[model samples]
Target: MTDFDTDVPPDATPHVCEHCGRPFARERYLALHRGLDHAAALSDDERAAYETAHDAETDDLRRFRLLALAGVVALYFGFLLTYAVVT
Candidate 1:
């Protein structure tokens, strides 16, 4: 293999930061990094992309929390029902 190939890992991130040269597995991560670490240096397009990614991540987190809450509620009711039947 070539020297360049040896430097990169087999599962290296495909998305790379333009300013800092950091690698990310996804474009969203790179956008977030750029926005947080290099905010003043970002162009209009980059800033927009970062906003979109941040919004998406926020929405996803909200959904996850809702799902977890629903799961806990369901388990609590199920256990109560089981105890009622046994007693």
Candidate 2:
């Protein structure tokens, strides 16, 4: 239906999930497919562990982003501090 479909290679259309061997149009769709379709099959303990691990990874990423932002701000102000002293 799309105008550029013929222009793109056939292999570029579908994204496959290695875990569930399912095809999706996008990576986010594949992730949603696995999380929704495949997750119900996991045991209660497995689901709990998965949720906990996801939470830990999210927390770690948040901390890393905040720290990086802080470092950038510090560096920017440190440059300004030197510039102010020089001028």
Candidate 3:
């Protein structure tokens, strides 16, 4: 019933890996999977593409972690300030 509990549609995965026919919701995910799972079979161009996608994904994850930490810190300070004013 929650927003996080929403189900994914069957057609959500449009990107199919050529190496394994495995489907992924995003092309980047497919690239990553291919890089990790089919490294032995990958050509030079596919490997390069995977490296680009992996770097982008890593940067995005780092940014998300920093933002989440900031949000948590802000909430903690806000709660402390509220308690100080009320008490």
Candidate 4:
């Protein structure tokens, strides 16, 4: 598997809507759901900004996890190169 394929943490749970207690597959979906269903009227620009920020917030976990995996891969290669030089 690719380094980006990080496993879900045992304690991690699906995103749930606070208003109605409905579960969503991803947190971003909940943000859109809330905006469309529950939030106050927002201007077009405000809505656009909110959606952008929400995407980053909800996707942060996966993004960081992939970065961590990339870090590990780098470390592994660094170790191998160091070993070769030592030998």
Candidate 5:
């Protein structure tokens, strides 16, 4: 099977950070997370990856919020229309 197979566990211990609860398969990830979150000492590649992931997550949340707002507005407008028709 390929390395990305979900059934296979990674070689390193599954250590999760106390601050973020982010699971890391390698000890190096703890250092990386500490540097990025607490120390602001991320390498260029680490910074780039973090920024990219953050942007994607932010975009997803924004889209979900917008959709939820739209649904609420539509429901409110529908209620108003029904009330107006009935009265």
Candidate 6:
């Protein structure tokens, strides 16, 4: 394995930034991407593709977070209802 790969933990996969094609050892490289290369980062074609992928990922994350929040709320209510019934 290369030095970059070696630096990354065994459980983590190395990611190349879709925008800049820079190999990042960590997943949190998105924050660096946003800060460093957000404006002049990508070629026109790459920019379009990156935007599409970013939007899809954002939408998926929103959907999953909403689902998780709903599950937590339902579980909380379920417990409250059971407690009320038991008491």
- Using TM-score as the yardstick, the better of models 1 and 5 is 1
Best by lDDT: 1
TM-score-sorted candidate list, best first: 1, 3, 6, 5, 2, 4
The parts of candidate 4 lying over 4 Å away from their true place are 1-55
Candidate number achieving the greatest TM-score relative to the actual structure: 1
Tens-place lDDT per residue, model 4, 1-87, is 122222335477866666666666666566676777766865575467568857777699789999999999999999999999999
Summarize candidate 2's per-residue lDDT along 8-85 as a digit string, tens digits.
346687766555565566654545455567796766755565566566667888999999999999999999999999
How many clashes (backbone atoms < 3 Å, residues ≥3 apart in a chain or on different chains) does model 1 have?
Answer: 0
Model 1 ranges with Cα > 4 A deviation: 1-13
The candidate, 4 or 6, that scores higher on lDDT is 4
Candidate 4 clashes between residue pairs 3 or more apart in a chain or in different chains: none
- Ten-residue region with minimum lDDT total, candidate 2: 1-10
Off by over 4 Å in 5: 1-36
Q: How would you encode candidate 1's per-residue C-alpha lDDT over 1-87 as one tens digit per residue?
A: 122222345566467776766666777888998999999999999999999999999999999999999999999999999999999
- In candidate 2, stretches whose alpha carbon ends up further than 4 angstroms from where it belongs are 1-37
Would you give me the overall lDDT of model 1? Answer: 0.84
Reference-based TM-score of each model: 0.81, 0.55, 0.80, 0.37, 0.57, 0.59
**What's the lDDT for residue 7 in model 2?**
33
TM-score of 2: 0.55
TM-score of 3: 0.80
lDDT of 4 at 50: 62
User: How far in Å is the alpha carbon of 10 misplaced in model 4?
Assistant: 35
Overall local distance difference test of candidate 5:
0.66
lDDT of 1 at 77: 100
